[model samples]
Target: MKKLQLSLLLMVFLVMAGCSQSETTNTEVNKLKETNKTLIEDYNKLVDKKEKLEMELDTYKEVDENSKHLTTIIDDFIHAAQKGDTATMQANISKEFTFEKQEEWLTAVNGEKNFPFYSDFYKTKLKSWYLQGIDYDKEKDFVRVFARVGYSDGEDSWYFEIIKEDGYFKISDLQYET
Candidate 1:
């Protein structure tokens, strides 16, 4: 009877041990599944962020390119003006040119009487030009630039109206202000 009782106790112990081990394994498997799900979610979020960053980078590149091109246009205009390349200057000027001192300049060139020193004016008054601002629309072929004309004694601000005609950029008009 003792032997039989001992064997029955050993059998019960073995069965309980097996059940506990199985439960532990099931819990570990569930934990692994949950970890895998979290990892997958995190991976997806990273991919989404990467894609958004790439899109933003592309947009920035485009904007940078446009800005560089606009700067080039401004530089070219300033170069032309500083060199007094009339052909180039006239090409870019709007159809009409306006100046607060337009009549004075014209009258000086026209040899009008009492128009203040004539030949000396042309030799000393016209000086360098500086580009102050440039703006353009990507969809439109027009760019507006603000420039400062440096003379012997003072600087004057002018606006250059730019447009693309027949695949060439030209200044359509010149305005003293506004």
Candidate 2:
């Protein structure tokens, strides 16, 4: 009887030990599952952030390309004016192109009537000229180009407003800083 009692106690201890170990393993498994869930959530958030950044990058690229193209147009317009090429200037300018100063606006009836004066003004008045930069207002569909114009008196900055019309960019208005 004594031996049987000892054996039963040993068996009970072994079963209790087994149960304790199983409970510990289950707890560890639950913690691991929770950690995995949190990691997956973090990964998803990172993926979303990456996608957003990529889209922003694409938008910037498009804007940069547009700015570059507009800059080229401005350069070509200037070159045409310098060469006294009325046809090129007329082609690049909007039909509604206007000269704006202070609060006053002036428009020509047509390019042929107006370009000669502009050609003379640029050639004689502006001793030297260069493009500084170009910016776009997407909502307004307007491009503002900054230029440094050198005159006999001094140098001045000018803003040229370019607008999109009929799927082409055209110089709409020119403004000089006072």
Candidate 3:
């Protein structure tokens, strides 16, 4: 009877030990699952950030391409005017281009009155003019070109404003620095 009692106590201890081991294994599995969930969440956030950066890069590429094309157009127009090519100059001028003069105040000259002024300016002031630099404003959809202009007496700097219209870039305005 004592031997049988000892055997039963040993069996009870073995079963309790097995139950404790199983509980410990279950706790470890729960911790692993929680870690895996956090890693997946972190991976998803990184993927989202990468996608957003790619989209922004694409937008900047498009803007850079457009700016290059517009710069070429401006260069061609300046070259044509320098060579006294009226047809090319006229082609690059937008119909909506306004000829404005501001000495003390601003005044909009009629096209009929403006043509002669433009002609004289191009023929005389722009004879030795050359483009120095160009800047673009994507949000405003406009370009600013810096040029070295030659006057009859001396040389100076000038700026031209170009705008996009009907899928083409055209000279919209000119401003000379005093």
Best-fitting candidate, scored by lDDT: 2
The sequence of per-residue lDDT tens digits that candidate 2 reaches over residues 1-178 is 9999999999999999999999999999999999999999999999999997797677556657788777777777765654555577668778764332222212233333332224333334547778897776655657789988676677767677888689887888765563
lDDT by residue for model 1 over 46-74, one digit each (tens)? 99999977976665565455655545555
Candidates 2 and 3 compared: the better one by lDDT is 2
The CA lDDT of each predicted structure is: 0.59, 0.69, 0.66
lDDT of 1 at 80: 55
Give the per-residue lDDT digits (tens) of candidate 3, residues 1-178. Answer: 9999999999999999999999999999999999999999999999999997797676557546776665566666666644555566667777764445444222324354343233333335544666687776556657777877666667766676777667777777765554
List ranges where model 3 is wrong by over 4 Å: 73-100, 104-178
How much is the lDDT of residue 106 in candidate 2? 27
Q: What's the residue-level lDDT of 63 in candidate 3? A: 46
Worst 10 residues of 1 by lDDT: 107-116
User: Candidate 2: where are CA atoms >4 Å away?
Assistant: 73-104, 107-124, 133-146, 158-178
- Which whole-number lDDT from 0 to 100 does residue 31 have in model 1? 100
**Stretches of candidate 1 exceeding 4 Å from the true structure:** 73-178
Predicted structure 2: lDDT:
0.69
